[model samples]
Target: MEATELNIRISFGRKHALALLSAFFLCWHPGFIGSETLQLTTFYPAPYGGYVSLLTTGGTNTVPANTILARNAGRVGVGTGTPDSKVDIRIPVGLGANGVQITDDNANPDTRSYATLGVTRAASGNNLAYIGLTKQGTYPWAIGVAGSNDLIMGASSAGNRTIPSPMFSIDTGGQIAMGGGAEAGRRLRVVGDLRVTGDIYVNGRIQGLCQRIGYSITGVTSCPWNHNVIGFLGDGVARVSGFLPASATTSGVGRFIVLGEDWGGTMICCRF
Candidate 1:
C-alpha cells in the first residue's frame, strides 16, 4: 500500500485572479456549451445581428425547405429568399393556406366600432393605387385607374392579366355608369330600369300625364266641364244622333244613333 500527499503554495496575482474569474463565468453562462443545455430566461440589451437566412424546423436536426430572409436593404421575406416589398409572404400553390387574416378580439361591439384592417395614403403624399380581390383560378376584380387614368371598378372573364370592359364604373368627375361607359357631365347612366316612387323634376318642372276625361257615347250628351269634344267613338259613324232611312218596314225616316259601335266606347275630350 502507498499513500501520496502533495503540498503546494499558491500565490495571488492580477492575471491569476482574472483567469479564475473567466473560468468561473464559462462554466455557468448561457453561451457555455460543455454538456448541459443552455437556457436563457431573458436577454439584456436584446439581440441584434445579421444573417443570410433564418429558419426553424419541425424536428430536431432537420433543415426547413422554406426560410425567412431579412435583406440589408430592409426587406423581409417569408418562404422566399428575395422580397419585393417591405414585408412579403409567399405561400406555395395548391397549399391550403390563403392570405393574411386580421381578427378583432373585442367581444362586445357597439355602433362606434373600429375596423380590423385599414389602408391609408403613404407618407409621400401619394394616394393608394388600387385594391383587388383575387382568387386562385379567376382573374382579379379590382378598383383602380382605367386606361385614361379614370377611377373605375372592373373585372375580367378571360385571363388573369386581362382587363375586360367594366361592368360598373365611376369617372373622375364622380359620374357613374352601369354599363362601363361614363359620359362627361352626366350624373348617372343606367342601362336598366330607373324606378322612382316620388315625382320626377326636369328643369324645375314636375312632369306627369295630362288630365283628361272620357264618357260613354250611348246618347247625345254635352261635354262635361266645358271641355272640347275631340272625336266620336263609333266606327265610320261620325255623329251619335242621326236619322236612318227606313227600308223594310215601310215607315218614315227612323231616328237612330250608332250604339255598340266601337264596342260602346267612350267619347274622347281634352282641355285646350
Candidate 2:
C-alpha cells in the first residue's frame, strides 16, 4: 500500500539537451575556464567589400581567413619591382641593427643599363667609356689602345716628374728610321743604367771593345799605339783615340782606326 511513492519522469531534446550539457561541462571543468580575453574579427567577402581589416585582442590565435593582424602600430608599402620580383621582409632575431642598409636619394640620380659588369657607379656625373680601369685620380688625357700591335710590358707610373725618353721609335716608309738590322730587329733592349746626354746619332755602327797588351786582335782592324790625347784636368775630359795594331810601321806613333776589329798589328808607344 506504500508503493505509490515511487514516481520518475525525465526528458530532454533541443539538440539532445545541448549535447548533454556539453558532456557535463566537459567532465566537470577540466581546465581553462572561458575568456582569457580573446576576440578576432577579419572578413573579406563580396567584391572584397572591406579591402582589408584585422583586429586581435588578448589572442590565443584567431583571424586567419586572409590574415591581416595589426595590434599596436603599422605602415607598410613597397613596390618598385625587379630584384627578382621583390617582397622579402625578415627581421627578428635580435631585431636588426646593421646588416644591410642602403638609403639613397641624393637629389635622385641612378641610371644603369647593363655593362656595369663587376663594380660600378656613376650616378650621373658624366661617365662615357669604352674602357676605364682606374686606380687613383686625375686622368686628364688618357688614351690607351692596343687592338693588335702595342706592347708596353711592365712598370708604368706617371707624375712626380721623370722623363728619360727613347726606348723605341721607328717609322720607315715615311723615313724616321732607327737601325739594328733585318728592317729593325733590335728596336730597343736596355738592360739597365744608361745615361746619355744629347748628341748621339748613329746611323749604323758605334760598337765598342778594347783590351790590348800583347798584340791583341779579335776582329776589325786599325790600331798601332802612339796614343796621346791625355787631356784630363777635371771638368770632363776623356776623348783619347790612338793605340794598338794600326799598321805598325811606326813613323810618329799615334794610330787607332779600329772599325769592328779584325786586328792587323802595331804597338810602339813612342814614334809620333
Candidate 3:
C-alpha cells in the first residue's frame, strides 16, 4: 500500500498492531514526508518595522529559530514595547564591526563629519592646554606659570644645591638682605671684595690680625726696622682689646702721630 494509506490504516489499529506498524513506517520512510531534513537558509523577517536583519555569507546556510538579531538598534526602543525605554543602545559584537568602521571614517576631519576624541579648550593668546606626565625620573629644571615674565618670586632653588645646607650661600650677582635673626655660627668667607654697610659684631676671639712679640725680623722681611706697632696679636702677642683707634694728630707740615692702647702696652708713633 501507499505510504499515506498505510499511515491511515495504522492510525485505526489496536495498540499492539499500531506499534508494529509505526516501527515499519519508520523503517520504510527514511527520507519521506516528516522524516526529510529541512535546512533553513534565513529566518522569516519579523513583521515589526523596526526589527533588525542579520545576513551571513560564505558558509553553509543554517540559522536557528527565535534568534534575536539585534538587541538594541538605537538609544531608544530596545526590548521595551515602548521606544522610550531604549535609553543607551548597544550593538553587541559581530553586529558592530560595520558600524565601527563607518564611525571611524566619519571621525576623520577630512571626512564630512567628525567626533572629538576628548574635551578640548580654545587657544587663549596662542596657548593651548594639554594633559601629560610632568616628570619621569630626574628632577625638573623649573616649574611655574606659563608666560608671566617674572623671576620666580617664592622659595626657589635657582642658585642653590639641595644636598648641602644653604646657610652660607651667597649669590654672586644679587644682594641678599636678611632681617631679624641672631645669625650665630655663620661664617662668610669671600675671596673678592666685601662691602658691609652695617656693624659686624664678633662674639669670639678674632685671630691672625696681630704680629707676635719677641719674634725677630731680618732685613729681608717686610717688618719695619724701627719696631713700629701694627695690628694686635692673637696668642703669643699683645691682643688689641678695645675698638680700633684713629690717628689723633692731623699735621700739615710737622710729623704725623698716632696714639693707641692695647692689652700689653700703649702705642706712640710719629710718621712724616
Best candidate, lDDT: 1
Candidate 2 off by > 4 Å: 1-7, 14-38, 42-52, 56-272
lDDT of 1 by residue, 1-272 (tens): 99999999999799999999999987855534433322223334547433433433221222212546666577877656567898976654433212332324543211113332211111111112333444443355545456565666665321122235666777778888986578898788787766799986678543232233444454545466646667655444344556676765656667665544453345666553
Most accurate candidate by TM-score: 1
* RMSD of candidates 1 onward, in order: 14.2, 22.2, 24.3
lDDT score at residue 33, model 3, on the 0-100 scale: 37
Model 3 spans > 4 angstroms off:
1-186, 213-221, 224-272
Estimated TM-score per prediction? 0.32, 0.17, 0.17
Q: Least accurate stretch of 10 residues (summed lDDT) in model 2?
A: 119-128
**lDDT against true structure, model 1:** 0.50
Worst 10 residues of 1 by lDDT: 118-127
The whole-model C-alpha lDDT of candidate 3 against the native structure comes to 0.30
Clash totals for all models, in order? 0, 19, 2
Q: Clashing pairs in model 3?
A: 76-86, 210-232
Q: Candidate 3, 133: how far from true, in Å?
A: 22
lDDT of 1 at 94: 32
